[model samples]
Target: MHAGFTLVEVAVVAGILGLLALTMTSAFEGMEQARQQNTAQAHAEAARQALRTFMLRNKRLPCPDNSTYGDRGREANGAGSCPGDLRVGWLPYESLGLQVPVRSQRLRYGVHRGTNADLVAPLHGAVDGPDLEGTGGLARALATAAQAAPSTDQPHYSGAVPALSSDTCASAEPVNPAFVLAAPATDRDVDGAIHPGFDGPNRGFATSSPCVAPPARPATRIYDDVVVAESATTLLGWLSTATR
Candidate 1:
């Protein structure tokens, strides 16, 4: 008998080798994805902690439900509104001395608000009625100054509020919900406007009918991968206080 390996034996060996290679490849991919998810979660927790600290100091939450007083748009007289600026990236966190990591992608921050018009004005203070009581000292000051000079015609500072239907927090008109943190998935329905960081014009994120887009490609922002699931998409702070 010829001392040669049979064809069947060779085929079996080849099949086993292929299976081993596939298993290794899958394991590597899974590990990478897990690592990414962990990193994103860590960032999220950091953001939350920063906001909590801000609340402790300010006697109110960093991103108030119905106000944009401390949002990125008004940061450091607009110095922190740049895309790479740590102030805008982390919102109120930056002021607390936290340094956001410089990842391949940027993060977006958002605020949580209710549908109450009186509480939160729509369109960055557009509907902010007269501060008759002068509750909002800043708004009152702006109103006083604007009235002093008729030629100035400067718009009064309005409170930040959502302009969406009561049924859905999504805005029927173009309005920017203050971002508290960056999201992971781009395809998710984003209710807020684009940050001045992302918007070339002064306006924040623009509006789209569907309000959902494809998964932000790798080059987008790091947090673009972190999506807010529809069921749990309500503002975290709001959820904490809900009766349910």
Candidate 2:
């Protein structure tokens, strides 16, 4: 009558098996996440190495300006421009012989400058005066010329300035010569708030704003890695390894 086992015993065994299955599922999820993280880290390191090699061969860093070669020149401050005599711009990792799959978004280098709203001068008083009136005339012509001229603070690689989102790091400026290595924030959310920075890995920009509040929350992922020619390179990240 009891050759197999009691109903109660069978039920208990089934429960134990279910618990084990649940535990195994959780373990597997953790392993998968770990693997993804390791892969991402390895890819990032490879990109860095490739960049180093490119610099070594060309004696300059690649500048990403949407394929435009406008910013190549020498500034009074000693900053190098894009498409310099060296002719290096947007060095593709594939060209460098890297096997990793290149992310389209990651492939882009340099900051994206938004439209020049400020360049258009606002209408002022005395519109009818000879000094200010006349479309297509000398007065109007001068105004248009002034607007078209490059900003005195424009960067050499891309005369355009970086778009200033509300989430930009408190310390970030329009033209930062040291942007690559500086801890200035560089990312914003859909709402234009800056993400929190990682505290551990110690990579990426540091925030000058308070840690609390809506837009001040830290970032959750790594961002673009910007390198300036013959200068320090800055890595933008969301969370620090330590904090993670």
Candidate 3:
């Protein structure tokens, strides 16, 4: 009869197999994470381009998709206007004519929805074409509010306190938020727990909303959402070059 393997040899073989399994698992997990990140980036980029195109064509930005007013992706009021109180909501993908499904549309969008400076206000509504004043009033309004002191008029997206009127904390401040698009990361570390970076003040009403800057705070914070903002400066600059 042939001699069989020793006990230690069996144990060593088992340990090696275990290590191999662990390595394979880790590799798969890493691949999944990368895939999720890539998909999130692609979605954000596509949505950003769509928002810009819509603004260019309509001369006004479409409101976020508030659910009560219409379908899952349509504007709250069917292209008329967003509810004054609903500052943050889902991106109006359908309203923007986007093909993203309701189930896959996880992007949260927020805009400066002030009546005085409504970014959703139809600048082209006037028969004269663009705003009635014929001045760059629409774009100017957003710029003014974004630069003003922290208040209902200003846009915010993150946990940091809004900067003082004169203070310049470029890194901590939320300066470029004419509108913001936030996508929650797929890897929820806590599994079903609400993440502040994904559901916190940044996605709330104007009075309570915090300034938005992505990879949000708490040094150990996991699953930080991806956020992209469109600033008034950029919008105005684009408008300046448009064929209006």
Candidate 4:
């Protein structure tokens, strides 16, 4: 007859297996977060280029989309409002004639309407209430997604929050936002529960002062608002250089 292994041996093997599984799981989570971060940054970069392209060709930024999801989220006319609260909102992605269903598409965007003196006055000409049309838009174009569960709130993605303002912490602070993007570092609705960090009550609104430099990791109360600060003056500068 063959002798079987002792109970301790079995327990030890089980422990080893559990540890290995945990290690693998952790690794996967890190990889996913990193991918999301890169994708968010990519979206921001693309938007910056898109805004510049639109300005170069049309001499003005396209208005933000004001309609709801049903209408493709674009302004009916040149009269859309991104609300005073957000200081930003869904950009007129369609009007800009950009490709839809972008790889890891940006969920939403915010732009200063030339209100914050610090962000706009520096530009030397950009004005306030530069409101554009925008309604919260697609996680990806023409689709509804369920996050965490079948009946849970669908989570949105993250992007670059470029601003021109001096104080990032104060909300209700307006600026001449020139189409900046922002993303949630975490699930906006965590398993059907609302969550902060990366995505919070102020999804695109970063209430951190001095536009605190974005962290390499995800968003937190302290360093959650990752933004990119650009101004009309900067655009004008770019224009001048391009024309030269």
Candidate 5:
């Protein structure tokens, strides 16, 4: 054999090194993603707790911001039930008056009372929670107010009424009073829409409409959504001291 290896041999060694580097890169990415997801979950819990605090202080949940995220109260009357076409929109981060929960420190919140076209975007293809559809899910609980007994309380709500069924839209008395939160992380593609989905391991979100719930699908370009939800019973339970 010659004193030194041929060009082909050196090429083979370089290729092997390249492949090894790629594998390590992918592994690191996976680990970072797991960490980010866990962090997002913690943030959601914090937001939920903050919401409870707001209710304790105000005796009622804050309304959706009229234009988009932030702001507070309602659009039509500045108080009472959220008013809008679907009554579904981004969460009132400023309204709730809670510090941003993520280390990145950005607004990551969404809510749906009844109407939010994006929640069910690609409506037919997207999967909806059995108990958390915009119409059949959170919206249904809200509908309870319509059929519920009138309120004697000053804040004035329908009080308790029957919850709605996703399939039949039937009532079950004492609606659960749940709502959806679309808390996506940051923008990845650099496109204006920053709903949810990871450009890298650093991104995470509570939920991004059209994908809804968990098991976010990257194939559908609907990854990075982290949905956090609460029922009226659980969320407003604190109200017992003030309202009940």
Candidate 6:
């Protein structure tokens, strides 16, 4: 008869198999995360291009899709004369004719809300006058003035993936950004709830700054929010090029 394997050999084999399984699970998780990151970046770029196309055709920026005031995926009345306070909200996919796979992946949008150069309102009248630059001029001026602006230091936690403390402050603000697009990251804590600071200052109209840092931690905050910004100069340049 063939000799049977000892209990020690069986235990050793079982442990080795368990370790291999664990390693494979980790590798798969990492690959999925990379895929998600790439998809989010592509979606953000698409949204940016769509905004440019919309502006080139309409001569005005669309207001964000404010679910509180109207239906989802559509721009609010603000596009015509968006209230000065209504500056940041969900991307108006319907207004821009932009599409994405699901609502969860929709970008958060923020337009330049300077009183001197409100960008969300219709610019038809401005373009009708002798000086073809109306809101465009104001935006240009803001962009120029912001060239030497100082960075904003806000109180927040430390670390890149998870905050270890709460007494630190960094130059965390984007000065005079003409527009910003942000995509929320996956739940790093895996607690089924998104941490408040994960998206940094890109949360809401009140909390959303012109821009924010990514993968930053702010006091136990799990963060990896992807963000993109367009300067007024760049936008006006594009508009000029597109119209010419």
Could you give the C-alpha RMSD of every candidate to the true structure, in order shown? 12.6, 17.1, 6.2, 12.7, 13.2, 5.4
Measured by lDDT, the strongest candidate is: 3
lDDT of 5 by residue, 145-229 (tens): 3334422211111222312211121222222224444444433334333433432211322222211332232311223434465
Residue-wise C-alpha lDDT for candidate 6, range 1-244, written one tens digit per residue:
7599889999999999999999999899777666666776787788889888777666666787756322377777645656667667778888888653465566777776554455665332333455354445544443443353433321111123423332222344435556667765554444332323234344432143333443233322343456666767788777666656
True-vs-predicted CA distance for residue 214, candidate 3, Å? 1.7
Q: Write the per-residue lDDT of candidate 4 for residues 1-244, one digit (tens) a residue.
A: 7499789999999999999999999898767666665666666677678767765554444554544321354533543342433333455667666654431243354443332221111222222333222111211111111111121011121224434222222233223333445544445333232213434333323332112232222443223334444544566557556545
**TM-score of candidate 2 versus the correct structure, residues matched by position:** 0.36
Model 1, stretches more than 4 Å misplaced? 60-93, 113-180, 183-224, 227-244
Q: What is the lDDT for 46 in model 4?
A: 73
Q: What is the lDDT of residue 173 in candidate 6?
A: 44
Backbone clashes for every candidate come to 24, 15, 7, 34, 9, 1
Residue-wise C-alpha lDDT for candidate 1, range 1-244, written one tens digit per residue? 9799799999999999999999999898666656665566566566666655453333223322111323332233332222221212224345545663442223444332222211112222323565342234323222333233211011111122422222132323322222334433232223344432222111221221212111222322222344221111233234334312
Candidate 4 lDDT (Cα, 0 to 1): 0.41
Evaluated against the true structure, the overall lDDT of model 5 is 0.40
Q: By lDDT, is 4 or 5 better? A: 4
Q: CA shift at 32, candidate 4, in angstroms? A: 1.6
Candidate 5: segments with Cα more than 4 A from true spot: 69-86, 100-177, 186-211, 214-222, 236-244
lDDT of 2 by residue, 161-225 (tens): 33322223222222222112212122322223222222211121222211111111233333322
Predictions in order: lDDT: 0.34, 0.31, 0.60, 0.41, 0.40, 0.57
In angstroms, the error of model 4 at 46 is: 1.1
* lDDT: worst 10-residue window of model 3: 162-171
Model 3 TM-score is 0.73
TM-score per prediction, in order, is 0.43, 0.36, 0.73, 0.58, 0.53, 0.72
Could you tell me which 10 consecutive residues in candidate 4 have the lowest summed lDDT?
A: 134-143
lDDT of 3 by residue, 97-162 (tens): 787554433677777765466788733233345565434566666566556554533456433543
Per-residue lDDT value at 131 in model 4:
20
- Which run of 10 residues does model 2 get worst, by summed lDDT? 233-242
